[model samples]
Target: MQTFHLDAISQDRQTLAEPYHEFLRTRDMSAGVYHMEPGSHDPQGAHQEDVLFYVIRGAATLRVGDDELEVGAGSIVHVPARVAPRFVAVAEAIDVLVVFAPAESAPTIEVKYTA
Candidate 1:
């Protein structure tokens, strides 16, 4: 068994991509922490795995498909496979916990993302 701490991980995270720190990877899933500056854009694209985003801090508007939602600390959002999500109008820097079930694979479609 293994244990992880958020603050320590956040400070020392080895970023595989800008703003996205992939902390754990397993056969069944992967996990990461995504942090954005107040006006920064999210550069991730759609993934082959279904994903969940848990808002740990900050505020922003989350868009999935044609729908948009206001999200802040403690907000949880889900996106299905092949769908792109984005966070717009970021009112503050945000940290989001991202999880992908069955891990992530190369996208078969166009690219874009949120957290």
Candidate 2:
């Protein structure tokens, strides 16, 4: 069985322009870590596959379509395929574990940056 340690995964210094680190990928699904700084937000978009986000550290206000809620470390958020999702009002730097089923290819729609 394949094994991964979170500490080891976090130690990798690879910087992404999009604030994400893809740590695992398989035929069935893919997993990655996303980091966002305070006051920063994710671009609004939708994925082709169902996606799951597990907050690993910090907190933020997450918006899924017309709904919005506060999410903190240990919270899990799910976004169905082709549903718009975004994060905002970050109180602190946030680290989230992201997973996509059936492996994500690309966004179903064009991404829009949020200010």
Candidate 3:
């Protein structure tokens, strides 16, 4: 049996797409707890896998497609494969849990940003 302790993970400010924090990914599943500070926005990049975001603390504005929703503690957001979606922490601090299947096995679309 394998277990991951949140405290055991280093608070390394790793950048994924745009947001930065301690992100832990496994071989079968990718999951992480994000800490988004006020006035900070995490860049949205489309992935080839289905993803879900669970707000564990604070609040944020979720942009899924053309609709915007306010998400806070106990709120969960799901992003389907090939769907382009993004989110930003709107409150002072937002803590969220992101879950997704391994990229190699999941069907995903890449969202590239160009200037």
Q: TM-scores across all candidates?
A: 0.87, 0.86, 0.71
Q: Which regions in candidate 3 have their CA more than 4 angstroms from the true location?
A: 10-27, 104-115
Residue 64 in candidate 2, Cα distance off native in Å? 0.7
Q: Count the backbone clashes (under 3 Å) in each candidate.
A: 1, 0, 3
Question: Scored by CA lDDT, what does every candidate get?
Answer: 0.83, 0.83, 0.67
Q: Candidate 1: give the clashing pairs.
A: 45-112
lDDT of 2: 0.83
Between candidates 1 and 3, the TM-score winner: 1
1-115: candidate 3 lDDT, tens digit per residue: 6576655432443334435343556676677676777887666566677778888788778877666899989998888766666775477577777787663243345565444
Task: Please identify model 1 stretches exceeding 4 Å from their true place.
Answer: 14-17, 106-108, 111-115
lDDT score at residue 34, model 1, on the 0-100 scale: 85
Candidate 2's C-alpha runs over 4 A off are 13-18, 111-115
